[model samples]
Target chain A: MLVRRFVRRIAQFLIVYGIGLAGLLGLKYVLALSDYVVPDISLILETAKEVIADYIPAVFSTLSVTILGQVISIILAFSVGIAGRKSSWLGSFIRVTAYNIQAYPIVALAPIIFILLGDGFISRLLIASMICYFPLLLSVLGVMAAPVRDIEHFYRATGRMTWQLEVKIRAFENLSKLTTVISGSATLAMAGTIVAEFVAANAGIGYSIRTALYQSDLAKIFVALFLIGIIISVYQGLLETVGTWIIQKTSTEASSHE
Target chain B: MNKKYALFTYILLFLPYSFLCLLIVTHSAQAKEHEIRYRLKWLFNTSVAGDIYANKAGYFAAQGLQVNIKEGSPEKNAINELELGRAEFGVASADQVIRALDKGARLVVLAQIFQVNPMQWIYRDDQPEIKTLNDLQGKTIGITFGGNDETIMRTLLTKAGIKEKEVKLSGVRFDFMPFFRRQVEVWPVYRNSQGVILQDKLTKEGEAVRFFNPAEFGVNFVANSIITSEEMLKEQPQVVEKFLTALLQGWEAAMNQENETKVLAAVKALDKNTDARIMQKQLASTRGLVLAEAEAKKIGAIDMPAWQQTEAIMLQAGQIKRAVQVEKYLQVR
Candidate 1:
């Protein structure tokens, strides 16, 4: 039954995305046809190639930062989240802090961080970490705080070990939210990194975009945005697929017990 | 023996890393400790001769000065920056230093860069609408506030007996092509930059702007003077002298035909898209404007009457109400 529901949702996602993509592609072709009579399509094509090459590195760099940021955030989130959930007062402060940090993206922090840390990977790392960490904290808080009463009572009644109960009850229950937050945070980290680079960077995709903007090189600008979009989409899809497998495995274990 | 070996090995491993950290720190530290700070008229534009020319010629370096060449906003508040001590010196008109002296700021002129005003009023050729100063009698002229170029123009107008109330007013040309294409009729463009550009094109086609030269007509302020605080003049007179000596050398190198390639290369490095020959032509214009007729006269020297005449024009132009004694403002070298 769950498989059927998941498949229907997946189909809906694809249909919506496909229509949007196809419409954009159709519009692009129509615009190209309506261009000046002696079209310099090759010039634009070459420009696109340069832009793609520049973007590939930024996409990869952002992915790496995002992954590091996500991992750190997860560890922090879970630890803080569990403690806060157990203590009602602590939970409110943690929740408020975590929610506010979502707004601390790279553009906001890059300049000050550059001044303090002296501008390089360290400044960028802090920006990415701040953006990525917030989502994980939110996800962790939601699940740990909202653990179904029946599951909690069962664990308490069984006199099961705390760590074991944590893995089975809270972790199992919150897997979907955990995966979603991790993927979202990673993508957000990439965006934050780009904005950070734009302000005080020697080089990066952000720097490339900045220089292009300074000189009014529009082709390169579009190219950078397109490649960033492609990278994020691919990562998101990969995360969701992995998440579905985990969900399927957990469900199968539950069915076996039944 | 084992502990000693471990200690030695650790030092060897960390030695290069420590050296690299030291290099980075030293480099950035050098930037902050620069003795001289120069606020330019524009952010990294090659049109201004001082920043790029000074930087390129190693003139500042020879004076034991590390110049932090910062960008300037459209304000030409270079005088304000000088007064504020955001920097040791700034670039503005010689007339500005004179006017600003009486107004509670003690800005002193160090050296004059452009003796002839490389400043002019440019109008579109198609605009048969503006043929003379009388034709510009009611047109909106875009002007940058607190600048000598606009001040000089207004004075020339008053001398021609044109009233300020008679003409329409607008902001300076923020957009280049639109201004040139007659969105606005009159603007103060740098003679070496936009004025020579439009003139050459028009002259090539045998038509030109009915330009009223400020120097020839009425307003003649010394254009583009290297300025410092009056305090810097008294405190570091020797350092100021050395700087002037270096600048004279730079100007000679910059103006001569033999150093044309070197200057153009420097120009191109600062602005990548600048056309080489056009830039050289502009370079020629810049050199020509810099005491072209007055080279036989003392270099970096100003005549007292010329300075006062320029200031009086500004007063008539209504840029400033107060009079500045030219002798009190000038450093008699």
Candidate 2:
């Protein structure tokens, strides 16, 4: 039954995506008939070749920044998230700060960041981390503090240490929520990395977009976007798989123990 | 045993001395390579061929300088970057310099790259000719809202006795489809780079394109010029001179007929998308703009009269509140 359900889900996704891809391909041809520049498969292939040869370094740079930022966010989320959930004062402070930081768009802070850090890998990394920082922290905190009566009574009755209760019991109970937050945060970090690269980077996908805009080369711009989309999709897909496996394993373990 | 202990002690002493010498050598080597950051007015293209060539051709390295060239977007203000000390040197247009001066950003112009501003309106030749500014009336023209093209177009319209209502100003957002579809009769493009590409594309579709140059009609808005913060000028005079000298040499080499292949190769490294054939034509146009009918010796020359005229035009357009002594900011060699 489980395998059949999973197959149905996969088929549903493939059908939807297949239709979307076909529609896009049809649109490309329709536009091509006019004087409008449209993306061709050959152009995409050529662009990919060029990017692999000349722009792979930038792709790696952006990935490195995103990975580093997401890792930092994971650390901050685990530590500060718990503190925020456990202490009312700390939680209020974290909420207010995160809200303020997230409210001010990264574009507005880019100049100040560029000034403070100078335009380099460090600035890009900071901007990416800043963006990824808040969402993960808030989600983890919210999940940890969620009032589940049964779990709460069990922890209290067992007289477990606060650390053990929070780390083992609470985290497992909220494993699925944590997984969703992490994947979203990772995507946010990728976006932040691109934005940072756009504002002040010397090289990267964002820089390529900027250059393409200046030249008004729509083909090159689309190519860069296509590459970036592929990258983000692959990264998110990996995260999703790992997240699902962990959630499944942990939930199964908890149910068996119960 | 006593001799072995003495030898070990001597080895330890020599290691420390050698390590100290290595540190001194490394520090001096690093010091020799004075790191400087330069920000461009626009992204990497043939427009910045000279600057990129300077770095790529070992001119900066030859001068014992390590230069980091940062590309700028339409949203980026090179003058602001210079003012904030994020970049030691930057490229700015006459309009931006005027605005920066009015806003109290102490920047000095180093070298004017494009002697003739390449910001011009491109129209399909099949359409009615825009030979005079009056011909532009009633036609939809594309302009980037906050760009130098907008400033130049506004100045020209005012000078031509055309009101805002007389001409339809369409705000362009990096999309050429509107222009291609004849939604905008005229579109702004850099004659050297984007203009060449546009013209080629249209020609392939059996449409001939012509550029309406503002300089030809006496507006003569100045384009990209090298700019450095006042503080950099005051403090690092030697470094500035060294950088300028090497940069000028690079520009000269890039523009030279014999070095076309080498220069274009360097440009292709930075701008991988532009076609080599189109780049050749763009390079030719770039050379014409930089030289501006002057002798080869006049490469990177600051056209003071042109600068004055540009400032006067900006003032007339009310782009700046007060008249700045533009001459005072020019550091022409």
Candidate 3:
């Protein structure tokens, strides 16, 4: 299942990336644009070959930040979502604050972040977490707030209901959705880190992209995008596989207990 | 019913005729005016005072040309716009032109605007003056990696026979905190624009600052220049001549110290955010760069040796794969 999922993700990314490249090439041909504007396939391939070695290390640096940021965002999102699941005023306040904080664009806040934190790992991580946190929180909140009425009623009537069991039941019932949201947020985390690097930081693939832009080298940019897309697809696929295993393991345990 | 149908047919035929007439009128007007788009290399500031002056003072109109002077940013590359058929003419740095040419972009240089490149380093007056290239040794200098400043700085260091480890090279962003905190002893800035602002701020704080111009140290990397597609120059040679003449005239008049106040007012209208005092100083600094005493009459002369040196510098720095023989592209009117 894991191998199949990984293969499927990689195939899907290649197809989409191929189509995008074809579209760009079509535009270039129709317009008769020089390599400076939209590079030909040969130029892109040559540039990719030239830059791949240097870019791999940069990509790994970005990937490391992306993984760390996603982990941090997931923890924060789950905590906030679970706490804000109730209908109390405190819960409402927490939800409102999360929404408001997410509304402020990260680009606008980046300068202050850089000033306070400097353009280092911390700022990139902070920006990445902030970017991916809100969406994950929204998904978690939706799942956690909706009660499993039929199951919850049985426990409540028998006076055996506890918050821990209640939370587990809700999470278990919505396991698929939680997994999807967490997996999807990885893309946002990657995007956030790239933006942080593009805007200020001196390292990472995004910084390389920025340098490529300075020289107006579209081929290098194309290569960078290809690597980023491939890496993120693999990551999302792994997340889904892990999620499937967890779902299968939990269901088997519950059946055995019964 | 038959009479009504005949009247409807007549109305439809008349509509087509009217549309054709309108198209012809617009075409004729455009032909008479010779409308073209001129993309600037940067935003509206003292750096582009003459460009602003040209439009405001009706220089293009005087030459029977209708030019839409578009402001430019890093993303709004003139070469791309030219290829995309969006702009007929533009201002690009020598490095950009050479790089574009290396990649098969058919661009031509019409004029070199800045005799002295405005990209320079600023340091506190208290620091030891870098009178010699060796004086740069051990100084923590800031350069925007992947920018022309970085190439120019590297070339300077190489000329001084200094290794990379000899001086601490700090990569800078748009932020100036590192420079302000004295963590980076030298910072790169456009001498006319950011240089003026920084100097003004430091001056107000009872501190003096000095600019270290690369040109002074014999690194004559060319800056901004007027450029057009090779096709435009070939097909519309007359129009190109008219546009270049009017642009050079606009630059000449704008740089004349006598027209300083009028030029300042024109620039102020476009750039409302900059302080009036800073704008004045920026324009004064720009005048010297744009029109050195010997080249005062020829505001837009193309410096051939500087262009060759610029190409050489880019080649040595690996900014370009090979020399594009940039001289072939420079069409000095």
Clashes of each: 1, 0, 0
- lDDT of each residue in A5-117, candidate 3, tens digit only: 89999998897788667766766776688999999999999899899999999998999999999999999988988999998897888888888998999999988899888
Tens digits of lDDT, candidate 1, B98-210: 54554446667766666777777777556654434576677777664435655666666666678878876553523354354565677778878776666776678677675
Best by TM-score: 3
Against the true structure, candidate 1 reaches a TM-score of 0.47
Q: Order the candidate numbers by lDDT, best to worst.
A: 3, 2, 1
- Interface RMSD of each candidate, angstroms, one decimal: 25.2, 24.4, 9.9
- Pairs clashing within candidate 1: B118-B191
Query: Candidate 1 - CAPRI tier?
Result: incorrect
Q: Which consecutive 10 residues in model 3 chain B have the weakest lDDT in total?
A: B24-33
* Recovery fraction of native interface contacts for candidate 2: 0.02
TM-score, structure 2 vs. true: 0.53
Ranking by DockQ: 3, 2, 1
Q: CA shift at A236, candidate 3, in angstroms?
A: 1.1
Which CAPRI category fits model 2?
incorrect
| Cα lDDT for residue B161, candidate 1 | 78
